[model samples]
Target chain A: MLTAILIMTGIAIVLGAALGYASIRFKVAGDPLVEKIDAILPQTQCGQCGYPGCKPYAQAISNGEADINQCPPGGEEGIRKLADLLGREVKPLSEEHGTEKPKSVARIDEQVCIGCTLCIQACPVDAIVGAAKQMHTVVAPLCTGCELCVAPCPVDCISMAPLAETVETWKWKYPVHELRSAA
Target chain B: MISRLFNFRGGVKPESHKTESSGTPIDQAPLPKRLVIPLRQSIRSTARCLVEPGQKVLKGEHIGQGEGSLGTGVHASTSGTVVEIAPYPMAHASGLETLSVVIAPDGEDRWIDRVPFDYRKVSREEALGWLRSCGIHGMGGAGFPTHVKLGSGTGIDTLVINGAECEPWITCDDRLMRERAAGVLSGAMILRELIGARRVLVGIEDNKPDAIERMRAAASTIGDDVAVVAVPTLYPAGGEKQLIRVLTGIEIPQGKFGTDFGVQCFNVGTAHAVHRAIHFGEPLLSRIVTLTGNVAHPGNHEVLLGTQVAELLALAGPKADTDRYIMGGPMMGIELQSLGVPVTATTNCIIAASPTLFPPPPPEQPCIRCGECARACPADLQPFELYWFSRAKNFGKAQEYHLFDCIECGCCAYVCPSHIPLVDYFRFSKGEIWARERERTASDQARARFEFRNFRQEREKAEKAAKLAAKAAETRAKLPEAAATAAGTAAAAVAAEPAASPEDLKKALVAAALARAKQQKAAVTPKNTDSLSAETQAEIAAIDARREKRNTQDADKTP
Candidate 1:
């Protein structure tokens, strides 16, 4: 019985070592998924997703507390792409986050003269680079076009202006109106 | 044990919670005054809104038309005066707006017309056409246009009718299969006609013996058109790939469609929808919605389209402060934020009654050294490995373990003694990956646009230089002999400069011309609001916005 016990211990040691070695040797490095999810976010750096920023949201997505449909800025296409990646059923954007709006930038009217600077403080992307209690102007170029500043405006001076169509921003959509003028 | 050899690994094992409200007959909900019929309920594109707002729309009247071959028409759920044709809150978590034609229902629920055809005489194409015209789509959770499915999946040899209602608390399909066997068979015939497969297999789970028996009887009556196969009861066995495998002993390769195996599957309820579409030219308006879970009355009810979920809950006698509202089955269902979400074609069941339906989410804890989750995983993955990788946010290792194949069935979480919420981890990883990808794509697009814009600006500069040179040459050419001679002598001397080549001389002339052009270009700008076209100013603002946030984090991470 003693001999048997000794042999069992020897066998157990061998098996455990084999498993331990495999664990170390086969240890794959770096998850490619976080990168992919981070790529899909709007990157507006807005906490509208209930996270500190887009990267955190991407991490949260990897964690599953947030739904793929929460990025209203990314719209349906973004949700669909996320669904494809995660293999989750692609439902419409989660309504709690808000709906898809026309791409807009906040334009603060200087003449309104309130100078409350509330909108500036609320800018998630630091799009409003201005002094406190002074006439604040929106740095349109820095804005992610998130429109988060509109809500915080005290006197309602901030208005969302639909970004203009330009050659740079425009891509030829797959010609959805193919039948037009042909018939 | 034999089945275990082939099934995929790593499924979830969520509590069925079916007992909250099952084993009861369906109760009727009080009809609302206005039934808001959305034009785009099915997976297909929204049907054309045929009826203008404020017109009297009769029940079953074709109010919306299916677009081309990939659409289903919209029908009025009940006869009433059309109240509005405007955007309203849709049955989505987004609370997004959709075009809805609201009808204030009168006392009399009436259908406008019923165009019935002989089922026997209808050709396959004709039948498919009728199905499209009638506006039928898969009532299964996917809501794929039904006619599109019937349109041949090339080389298909088997038609698997999904009766494996495995999700707990959802019995609408079971009740429909048991009660309307003949209609289902007729619908199957239409499908058989749609795709001339070697054989049609009807797979009902053993749990539903009555449904199985009824379906078998229906098959016998239909003769050799369809074959009845009873698969062992298993959660998510109704999944097209899973059901197909149970019937035909085949597995769908990952990242491939079921058609690769020469098989097609349809929900039993979707078949009935097909039958309604083919027999009576009826658009898919109403469907058998399972009213169960935490409710007093638990069964199947044929609810109209665009029915408010709140009213449906009232019908079920939902408890005040019911904890959860799940659309479809608990395993794959979504949690709804509000009861105001309208019911659509894809809404098969609404679990809206129990505190037990979705108890407070399980307290998450570190996984113990237990292999229960591995044993329970249907996909045969070492979910423990996935769990470690997922928890660490090491998506690479998780993917190596076939993370994408984990169906998020909650089997691992259910079986886990530690209750790790493993699915949530996997979900989070996937979402992060997607978010990253979107950022990458937008950056790539931005980069390409920037490059193209720079190239265009360069070309414009070159063109202006050429124009200025041409103007100088023309002015020189028009000069009189003595003046022209003087000019030529000066030009020749400049050209003859020892340091200057012919190319240099040409470049110098071009530079002088370009300087002039630059001044002109600057001068040409509209000084005031009136001078600036609204279109031009808008363009300038957009360009300015583009320059501000040029670098995106996603672009830096993804290739």
Candidate 2:
């Protein structure tokens, strides 16, 4: 009984020391789980999740302050992915944030734009380019379809145009199989 | 010579309707009223448009310049004036519009200055660039740029020319070999010289006896040790990997090039185009398209690249009940969106499909685990499992089963007991996977940009703070000097009184500095006021008085 106790005590102390050293040596500087969650969230920066950006939202989720179903741009597909990652039950999207819509980009009406630079300032991704009192244009590829620039346009010149499907962007649809029962 | 041949597992033998179109001689199609040539001809990159609207172009003039080594040049099929450069419906599975150049033919049939390419005089890289300029792509319906395949020509020992023509009702290659055997041989010889290969083997399906005899006779005349061997007639035998396996007995692993196996494969039609490009200095402006399926005069015609499918089908006398048109073979062809779509470089066969000829597929049924698809898959993959995984939307599981290796040959679908469209599911799964990958990349890029913007904003704030701090430091540095001067001047005044302490000297210095600031403020004059009228000056004075009263009131409240 004495030898067993001594051996057990010695093993526990060695293992504890090794674990303590490993924790310090392999210590991550920041919450890496937040980074992984941020990778899963679509970086639209639309604040639909009630956070300032995707990173802040990820931090909130990591802290258990935000729900996973709040992001509408990520849609149901995103909620499912988050649920899979967090080992939680999949939930429907919240009703208050926004409904999922087709992907679109902002287009500026060059004629009506007064060159006030308001929309440019409102753009979160810096996808708009122009000088003060000059016509502003949106780089379609860079625009994240956040709808943040629409409200700031004084002349209501900025419109969210749904992206048109071309040969390059076409995708094959899922095949639907209808099965008839033997009964 | 009887060369030993290898066989690929899991292939189905459907009834071949080659005799319907292969019996007729090749005919030259007349110039149409308009030709709409798409800029995105090859698979890699789209050619940049060189000719604008209203520009007159010769028959062989390069209207679209190839982008890079992978891009092939596009030429005007006939001398004409470019009517418009706009988007038109393309012959694709998606039936979407692509950027095309519309030309109204003038019927002049004029030619540009043709000069033969002397490959012996120039470097291999230069010759390959010339080939890219000649618009030579694999005409076997893949439309892969030939120069890209030939560029990596080192370590290649055998050049296999594919004449299998395995797909049913596609006999353009068969007719080409039977009629233009010499040209194909010459192109093979050119490829051999360019790649420095020791042997050339032409693999034709045993179904095409006449083509084999003619190619053998032509090879004998060339005396270049070219071997013309016949392989078993099987569906998809003409596939690049399949033909290579049959000719050289080498299985190219997935994601690897055939050149890595000391062999390179080229279609017979591609070989003929190479001969034309090098010997006659002609670009790939036209191709021999097979017109068959529910037509009165089924034959092969060398149609120009941009001719409308309707016009070409009219020559073949399509029946009145024809409902649709298919672009490639019946096994792997896509149903054309409209008859108005133009024939592109990859168009080898156009089938006027009718209800009687090609009926609708039966309604899909649930899988019973028959395993017939596995027996019929040419790539030796399990099709039933892929179908289930794809049905369940489990892309990860499908990928684990090597879903990408399934070459959508329709063999599994043709043999499925449940009439399930297996290829469609595979296509959907592959597309979903690609789209997901693209989204991930896009999200990663957006994240990087967002982070960079945040960093930049933080840097700008820090820079502004530093500038303000530096200015405050400068002011503080100058204040000590001003205070010392005031203390020095007041030292004489303090000496008359009793000995003053250091605290008293500091107080006197601050008071003198405040008095100097007040004097300086009073001495300053406002510009643009000297030339103003008396009334304007009086108004400005009233405004200043109101501002001063408000400032005193604000200070009183705060204190």
Report lDDT (CA) for all predictions.
0.72, 0.88
RMSD for each of the candidates: 18.9, 7.7
How well is each residue in B221-270 modelled by candidate 2, as lDDT tens digits? Answer: 87656899998998888888888888788888876878888888888888
Candidate 1 ranges beyond 4 A from true positions: A1-183, B1-30, B39-52, B62-72, B85-99, B117-133, B151-153, B356-358, B388-401, B481-559
TM-score of each: 0.63, 0.88
Candidate 1 local lDDT, B63-146, one digit each (tens):
888776676778888888888887666655345567788888886888877777565586666766777777777777567877
In model 2, what lDDT does residue B422 have? 92
| Model 1 error, position B366 (Å) | 1.0
Candidate topping DockQ: 2
lDDT of 1 by residue, A149-168 (tens): 88888788888898774322
Report residue A26 deviation for candidate 2 (angstroms). 2.6
